[model samples]
Target: MNGILIIAHAPLASALRQCALHVFPDAGSALAALDVEAHTPPEQTLEQARQLQQQLGMPHTLVLADLFGATPSNVAAKLVDGIHSRLLTGVNLPMLMRAICYRHESLESLVSRAMMGATQGVVSVAATAPQNQSRRTSHDQDQHDHQQ
Candidate 1:
């Protein structure tokens, strides 16, 4: 199975991992997270990420980062080689959950699934009632008599 790794800003990575764990309690072994603390050296963060990836112990890993050009992504870029692992930016709860759910698939396929989840999860919700149910007005009256 492909392992999943989350590398993001402080607390975000761990929080995303927690969300995945909430949905799939048995995913601890196949998943890991690294929160890049502020002021920490990139080398240190990269090393920490390497350790987490190794601990996953899977043939391939999918690394998810919060932003494309930020510290988390930079560190992750240095960690992935494009063969055994791949990196995807703009990580979200939906993306992470999707990765966890499809971790047993090929690394390339997992990346596609994660990307789809991230993009598809974001949407413009309607302000009106769900399913377009009409709202009741004062003009509406009871049709049945209650007297017994």
Candidate 2:
């Protein structure tokens, strides 16, 4: 499995790691995080990233950041040399879980699965309500008729 690094603002990276570990205890061995604070210097964070890559054995690690066009992502961008290191933004629990589950897959496949997982995780409650809405409406109508 390629190494997994999560970089996010403040506690987000750490929190995501913790949450992922809750689901897959063995995943803690393969994942790490760098929480970037506002005062964090770019050079220092960049060096940390370099070390993380080295720890992950480089070029085969998937670097996930919390936000695109932001500091965490900016730092993560420097790691992508296009050799084998891949960078993906918008880190979330679902994406992280998918990555952890599919780590055995090729880097490309893992990235694809993570993206799919993240995208599929987002859902609108209203969209799901319609399935049982008719029953609810019928019950309410019956109650209203009795009241009348």
Candidate 3:
């Protein structure tokens, strides 16, 4: 099974893991089967990312980071050359969820898809909703309810 490792400064990684679990209740089992590791802590996160790559026997690992130029992103940057990992910044729930579901993909492909998911997730609701140019007064609801 291929592995997906998330590296964030302090609580972001764990918080994302919890959110993923809440979104997909069966993810624990699925994640275990896919060798996904969602870890956080000042000491072990980067090391775990490195070790997971080696253990998975893959030259590359897909690393999703919370912010660019931050500790987590910096740590992930260090592994780029050695482990063939791709570091994606601005990591969010959509990105993490997308990454977990598509962990089997190649590093490049996974990064691309995760980024797309993140971008799409940040849409405005008004833009998505159909525009109703015809304005209705407050009495509209009252009139329908009275007739019923």
Task: List the candidates ranked by TM-score, beginning with the highest.
Answer: 1, 2, 3
**Candidate 1 residues 1-148, lDDT tens each?**
9999899999999998888898899999998999999999999999999999999999999999999999999999999999999999999988888888888898889999999999998987645444567654555487432332
Off by over 4 Å in 2: 127-148
The residue pairs that clash in candidate 3, if any, are: none
Please name the candidate that would achieve the greatest lDDT relative to the true structure.
Answer: 1
Residue 96 alpha-carbon offset, candidate 1, angstroms:
0.9
Give candidate 3's whole-model lDDT: 0.64
Model 3 residue runs over 4 Å out of place are 25-45, 52-59, 127-148
- lDDT string for model 3 (59-125, tens) is 4566667778866777777766633667787888898788777877776788888899899879654
**Residue-wise lDDT of candidate 2 within 1-148, one digit each (tens)?**
7789999998999999999998899877689899998998988998998887787763488899999999999999997765577899999899999999998888999899999989988875533334445633564534532211
| Candidate 1 root-mean-square deviation in Å | 7.2
